[model samples]
Target: MRRKILGIALILLAGLCLCLSLNQADKYRQAEKTYDDILEKYTKEKKVSKKKQDFVVDWKKLWKTNKDVVGWIKMDSGADYPILHGDSNEEYLHTDLYGDYNINGSIFVNADNSRDWSDPNTIIYGHRMNNGSMFGSNKKYMEKDYLKKHPDFSIYRPDGCYVYKIFNVMVVEDGTYPYTYQFPDKKSYIEYLSKVKQYSYYDSGITVPDARQIVTLSTCTYINHVKKRLVIQGYIRQIREYKGMVQKRKINILEDNAFSKTEMEDTNDKEID
Candidate 1:
């Protein structure tokens, strides 16, 4: 009787483990699918143009109209959504009770707490979906050889497309998992980036690289959701201006106009390149 009871217990344990494993896998699959659906919607709404190969974002509508919903997370590809940070408007990780289109994690550039978007080596976060969508595609930057293509790209408010080149991919160190985002000063900011650049998977095409400005997109994965980070690094190559700078800057223009004044004030919003 004792032996028989023991055997039954073992069987139950095995079943429980199997159930948990399957359940976890299903969660990831569902996560992957959710991001895939988002991609489809984004692609269709973007309306691709092979000739120009451009994606546009309307700054005015993004920061204003979508603030309550997704909140200013717009890509040059015409993909705009409100960032679903934490439950509170001040938090970074966002969750939706319904599950669909709800990202259960927060996004941080550089570190989780830092908001300085201008720092180079900004690390962003998201989940890597088994479906190879959303931040999951960020994992592609891990392989050293694959670093050749897959350059980082960005679209700034008002109008601009900044291209990024991959340069680093390293496992997040234990003490540094919840990477801090803010810095005390610009010098420290640049110095810290130098440290991260040392871990770049490759040269990333830019020599004598310095940390002037950058944006990092991060997600959860690896052990305890802290070990691995698929970091795609890049610097802005050039800005594409379809409708010349209405909000311009002194350095970016020759004439003294409204656009130039705006540009000058917004000039601080540059990415590392």
Candidate 2:
């Protein structure tokens, strides 16, 4: 009789674990759908030339949804999401873009760094989810070949769009080097850059001279359960002014023709369907 009771309890425990796993999976699916909807609503790609294209985000619409929306980040390796700036670093760790609670949190900038992108180094954080959401794909940087193929990513702000070239990919203990926000002098900042490149898994051959603005993408890694973080660092390569007006219609521009005189004159003009 005791043996039968023990068997029944074991089966019940397994059923409970299965139910919890299924519930968590459903939550992730819903979270993914929400992000996909946001991307479709507020972002569109514009053909610059016959061979080139660029994407634009409706910064005005994003801000309207949540004033905390600061910028958007995109990478070819399946990382595209709106960035949020919360009151503290911990605010968005478990909060989604719509301020909802989920294991998959929104990408957020370091609270101590300047949101204007004027700081010497700005650090961005995201969760390394199991289903390759958020910064999960960032782990590919651990392989040098992957980094070579995908060395660049873009960030869009209200003022302009900025491109950053990845220079270093390193794994380190939390609260260690390269997590710093402020540097008292240029020399110290340069030294920090040197250490970043020095400790990288492989040299990316990118430079960060003159302390140009740099951004760090950080995500958790469970290599040995020692609280290691995978950090991908990059420096700004280009900046293009954002001049289009936000409207319901899509904003399309030709690179060869450039912005027309009328468009330049009326920066606030809405797009006509």
Candidate 3:
């Protein structure tokens, strides 16, 4: 009787573990579904041109539900995702664009930074999801060949596109100087850049000048016993006006001059590249 009772207890334990595993798997599935729904809506509303190879954002559709979405980030080919900026940096760490709870959070920017890209240094945070959803592919940068093939990524804004050339990739402890937003002077900023460049695993041959904006992509790393972060730093290299194949109305000089200063300013909200 004792042996039989013990065997039954073991079966119950196994069943409990299976149930927990299934619950975790369901969470991932729900997260994927949420992303798919957003993508479907966006692709349907936006126009696509094969010749130009551009995927423009449909601001009208996106702003209806969530106004926090500021821009989009596309890494190489398949890793394109909409970037979100919440009032608090920790808000989206567990919540999706639709306000659903999931382990895979939205790609978020630090609340302290400006959403208009005015800050000299902007930091974006994402989780390294096991299912290759958020920043899982960011690990590929550690491999030299992978970095070579994917040298740069583009950020799309309503006004234009900003291209950033990857210069440094390193894994350091959390709360380090790289993640800090405090730079008192140009000399301090340059010194911090030098430190990051020195510790870079590979010399990417990309330099960071004082005038250009800098962006840092950060993710959690678990290789070391203590908590660490995988940081990829890049500086803006170029800014190009977004063009499309479809040309609607051609404005003559007279028509352009007819608009007042306020009207023109409202049309094109100036943003720092």
Candidate 4:
């Protein structure tokens, strides 16, 4: 008949282009197997919750215990990242090119970029990574003896866990840019928090008293690479608890990212539709 109906329409257009390339490789293998099961459930809950918090970080007793800290930030820490607007409603923001977690560049705030835990200056941005991993020990807060030997960084919140006490670290010259992490007022956010503590490299006997609440971690350097931006300021502290309480709530800090780690369990196996 007309070459068997053009060979059955060329084998049904090669079975519909092999079922649309196996459905776009099954949506990047279900976003790489949900980022390797959230990086092996946040590297085994960051080693049993930093050995049950003796490692110390008391955000008013870890946000009053169970007030639901964004289900402790969607696990994984071999360190792959992408939370900035993983979608919308403010889709638990954290920005979409606006970012954090080693995956390079752009942030501005009152930032929750939706790392959501009822935001209040959650302001975060990362990529100080030089393979040590994201915020790559943010250059140990510019070495005033590595900011007194790495001040702090622990954040497990499936209900409780917090500690980010580097208090301040600095280097800001892209035209005095630190009024970010947002501030319409608090007297222009304490005049850009006392001009970013005159660029503090950690004396953090700490006192912002009330910029409402804070957390700022920014990155990008090489002004010799000539672009500048390498900041790390961790303000919210003393919310310690193995139990309950989480107060600051008026959040909408939009734009961001998260969840992931190394080799991602050898390219995260298969079957994810």
Runs in model 3 with CA error above 4 Å? 44-50, 224-226, 244-273
Candidate 4 Cα lDDT to native: 0.46
Name the 10 consecutive residues with the lowest summed lDDT in model 1: 253-262
lDDT of 1 by residue, 62-110 (tens): 3352332232344332223323323343243433312334443333232
Number of the candidate with higher lDDT, 3 or 4: 3
Ten-residue stretch with the least lDDT total in model 2:
252-261
TM-score of each: 0.60, 0.86, 0.82, 0.26
CA displacement after TM-score superposition, residue 71 of candidate 3 (Å): 1.1
**Regarding lDDT, does 2 or 3 come out ahead?**
2
lDDT (0 to 1) per candidate: 0.46, 0.79, 0.73, 0.46
Residue ranges of candidate 4 with Cα displaced over 4 Å = 1-3, 19-23, 30-34, 46-72, 75-181, 187-273
Best by lDDT: 2
Give the Å shift of residue 21 in candidate 2: 0.5
Q: Which residues of candidate 2, in runs, are more than 4 Å off? A: 243-273
On residues 138-173, what C-alpha lDDT tens digit does candidate 3 reach at each position? 888988788889978877776666778788898887
The collision pairs in model 2 are none
Spell out the clash pairs found in candidate 3. Answer: none
